[model samples]
Target: MEILKLTEKNIQDEHICCAISDKKCADGYQKKKDWLKTEFKNGYNFQKVDVRGKVFIEYVPIESSWLPLVGKNFMVINCFWVSGQFKGHGNGKKLLQQCIKDSKEKGMDGIVAISSDKKRPFMTDPKFLKYQGFEIVDEAPPFFKLWGIKTNPKAEFPKIMESAKSGTCPDKKGITAYYSNTCPFTDYYTNQVLREYAEKKNIPLTINHISSKADGQKMPIPWIINSVFYKGELVSLEMKVERHLDKLI
Candidate 1:
C-alpha cells in the first residue's frame, strides 16, 4: 500500500483518518486541519495510507508538540490510528516505520508517544508500542505513560512535565472540561453535545479550549484532545455521552 504524506499543498485536499464522513464533526474537522496547518510549519508530519479508511499517523518535533513533555531533539507522536479492515494488514507498521525514518532523517534523538499501562480510549496501545521496541520512559497519575524508542542512547529520556503529573485540574467544583481541536470530535462533543447533556442533567459544566501550545502544555492531562475533571479530580478523557455520564455522576 502506498503512503500519502500530507504537506501544506495536499493537506487541504486530503481526508484525515478520523471522522472522514462525520457530519457532526464537520466544524471540528476543519478546525483540526487549521491546527495542523499551523503546526506543519513547526515540523509536524502527518501521513496515511492510500486507502479511504482510518489509517494514519501524525508526529512533530517535541518542542513544538502541545503535550507537556520535556525532551530535546525528539519527535512526539500526536496520533497513530489504524482501524476497520485496515487492521492486521501491516498498515500500522508501515505508517510507524515512516515516522521512524522521518525522525531519524531529521537527526532526532528518537520518537515518543503518549500511551498508558493498558488499552484505553483514544490512547496508543502500550502493547503495540512495546512490540515495536518502545519502552516506558515516564509515567503520570493513575495510568498515563510515555513510551519511546531512542536512536541515540545518550539522549535524555523524555518525561511528563510536573504540571501534567498531578492528574487533576485546579477547578475544584462542577464538571470542568479542557479541549483542543487536536481531534475532529473534540470541538463538537465538548462544546455542543456535552454542553447540552450537562444542561439537561442540571450539572454545572465549564469548557475551556486549549487554543495555543503554551496553554496546552499547562493542561493537567497529557491527553489534551478532551479531558473532563470533576471536583478537581479527573473523571474521564473520553468524549462521553449521556449514558456514560449517568454512571459517572
Candidate 2:
C-alpha cells in the first residue's frame, strides 16, 4: 500500500483516516484538521494509507508532543491505528516504518508510544509494539504503559510524567472530562453530546480542553484524546453517548 504524508499543503484535501464519512463528527473532524495544521509547524507528522480507512500513524518530536511524556530526542506516537478491513494487511507496519524512517532521518534517538497492558480503545496495542522490538520502559496506574524503541540504545528512555501517574483527574465531583482535537470524535462528543446528556440527567460536568503542549503535558491522564472521570475515578477514554452515561450516572 502506498503511504501518504499529510503535510500542511495537502491536509486541506486529505481525509484524516478517522471519521471519514461520519456526519456526526464533521465539525470535530474539521477541528482536528485545524489542530493538525498548527501542530504540523511544531514537528508533528501524520501519515496514512492511500485508501479511505482508519489506517494511519501520527507522531511528533517528544519536546513538541502533546503527550505527557518526558524524554529527549525521541519521536512520540500520538496515534497509531488500523481499523476495520484494513487489518491483516501490512499497513500498520508500513506506517510504523515510515515513522521510524522519519525519526532516523531527523536524528531522533528513538520512538515512544503510549499503550496499555492489553488492547483498549484509543491506546496502542502493547503486543504489536513488543513484536516490533519495543520494550515497556515505564508504567502508570491502571494499566497505562509507555513503550519505546531506541535506535540509539545509549539515549534515555522516555517516561510518563509524574502528574499523569495518578490515573485520575482532580475533579472528584459528578463528571469531569479532559479532551483535545487529537481525535475527531472528542470535540463534538464532549461539548455537545455529553454536555446535553449531563444537563438532562442533572449531572455536573466539567470539560477541560488541552489546547497547548504545556496543558497536555500537565494532564492528569496519559491518554489525552478524551478521558472521562466520575467521582475521581476514570470512567472511560472513548467518545461516549447517553447509554454510556446512563450506566455512569
Candidate 3:
C-alpha cells in the first residue's frame, strides 16, 4: 500500500513494473523518465504509478486552458488505468478517493477529466464516480467531460483570496501525498498553495500522478492524480486557497 514517489533512482524498480504489466511499457521507462523531465519544465507534473501491491492506477494531469475554471490552479484527468489483475475490488474507488482527498487537502482549485473512447467503458460505467457524489458537469458527444464531480470549490476564489491573505492566511504543512506516480513537492503554484493550507487545516494528501504528455484526446498533460491530504484529513479551501496568488505572481 505504498504510493511512493518516482524519481530517477526508483523508476527502474519493481514498483513501476507492479504499476504497469506491459513488458513494452516497463522497457520504456527511459522514455518515460525523459518525458517527465521535460514535462516538469512545462508545468506538467507526473509520477510513475499509483501502486498498492501488484495493482496500480496510471494516469497524468493537464493544465487548465479554460481560464478561472480551469485556471492555472486546476488540472484535467486525461488517462486512468487499473492493473488487469486488480480490477473490481474497490481499488479504483480508493484510487478515486485519493484524488478527491488530495484536491481538498492540497487546496487545489479542482480536477477535470475527459473520458476517452478507449476508457469510456469504465469512465461511463456510472458506478465510477457517481457513488462518490461526482456529477457529469459537461459532456461533448462521443465522450463525456466531467469536472468538479468530486470537489467543485465554486467561482468566488478571485474576490475571496484577494481579501484573505492579509488576515492570517495560513501556514504550509508537511504532507504525505501522491504526485506524478512519484512524489513532487510544491514546485507548481497550485500544489504549493494547496500544501500550504494543509498545514493550516491539517490533513493527508493523495494525488493522481499524471504519467504522460502524449495527448491524443485521451491522455492530457503529465499530471499527478486527483487527491491530496493534510495531516491525514480532507479539507476544501479552494476560494480561500489562493490568498497569496497576487504577491506570488
Candidate 4:
C-alpha cells in the first residue's frame, strides 16, 4: 500500500482517515482540515496509508507541538493510529519509522509521544511505544505518560508542563470541555452533539475551544484535544457523545 503525505495543496480535498463518511462530523472534519493547513506552516505533517481505514500518523516539531511538553529539537507525535484490519501487518511500524527518519534528517534530538498508563481512547498504547524503544521520561496525574526515544544521549529529557501535572480543571461545577480542532470529532461533539445533549438535560455546559498552542500548553490534561471534566474532575477524553452522556446522567 502506498502512503500518502498530505500537503497544503491537496489537504483540502483529501480524506483525513477519520470521519470519512459521517455526515454529522462534516463540520468538524472541515475544521480539522483547516487546522492542518495552518499547522503545516508551523512544521506539521500528516501521513497516512492509502486505504479505507484509519491508518495514519500526525506529527510536528516539538517547538510547534500543541501539547504541554518541553523538549528541544525533537518531533512530537500527535496521533499514530493503525486501526481496523490494518493492525498486526507492520503498517504502524512503517509509519513510525517514517517519522523517525524525518526527525533524524532534520537533526532533531529525538521523537516524543504522549501515551497513557493503559489503553484509552484518542491515546496510543504505551506498551507498543515501549516495544519500539520509547521509554517513560515523565508522568502527569491521571495516568498521562510522556514517552521518548532520544537520538542524542546528551539531550535533555522531555517533561510534562507544570500546569498539567495536577490534571484537574478549575471549573468545579457543571460539565466543562476543553477541545481543539486537532481532532475532527471534537468540533462535532463539542459544538453540536454534546452541547445539545447538555441543554436537553438542563445542565450547564462550558466548551472551550483551544485556538492556540499556548492554550493547549496550559490545559490540565495532556490530551487536551477533547477532554471532558465533570465537577472539576477529569472524565472522558474520548469523543463518544452517547457514552459521555450516560456518565453525565
Best by lDDT: 2
* Model 1 agreement with the true structure over 13-128: per-residue lDDT tens digits: 88998898999999999999999888889888889999899899999899899999887899999888998899998988999999999988999899999999898888888999
Better of 1 and 3 by lDDT: 1
Model 1's TM-score against the true structure:
0.97
Q: lDDT tens string, model 4, 100-155? A: 99999999999999999988888888889999999998898888999999888899
lDDT of 3 by residue, 1-249 (tens): 435445545554534332244443343444445555554445443332354444434333334221112333445443444656567767667666566565566566666554422343323334555555645554332233444453455632211112211211122343433333232221242355556655455554333334442221121211132223333332221223334232232
User: Which residue pairs in model 2 clash with each other?
Assistant: none
What C-alpha lDDT, on a 0 to 100 scale, does residue 85 get in candidate 4?
90
Q: Would you list the rank order by TM-score, best first?
A: 1, 2, 4, 3
Candidates' TM-scores?
0.97, 0.96, 0.47, 0.96
Candidate 1: worst 10 consecutive residues by lDDT?
240-249
Candidate 3 residue runs with Cα over 4 Å from true position:
14-29, 40-54, 58-72, 116-126, 150-152, 156-249
Off by over 4 Å in 4: 241-249
Error of 4 at 114 (Å): 0.8
lDDT for position 47 in model 2? 93
Off by over 4 Å in 1: none
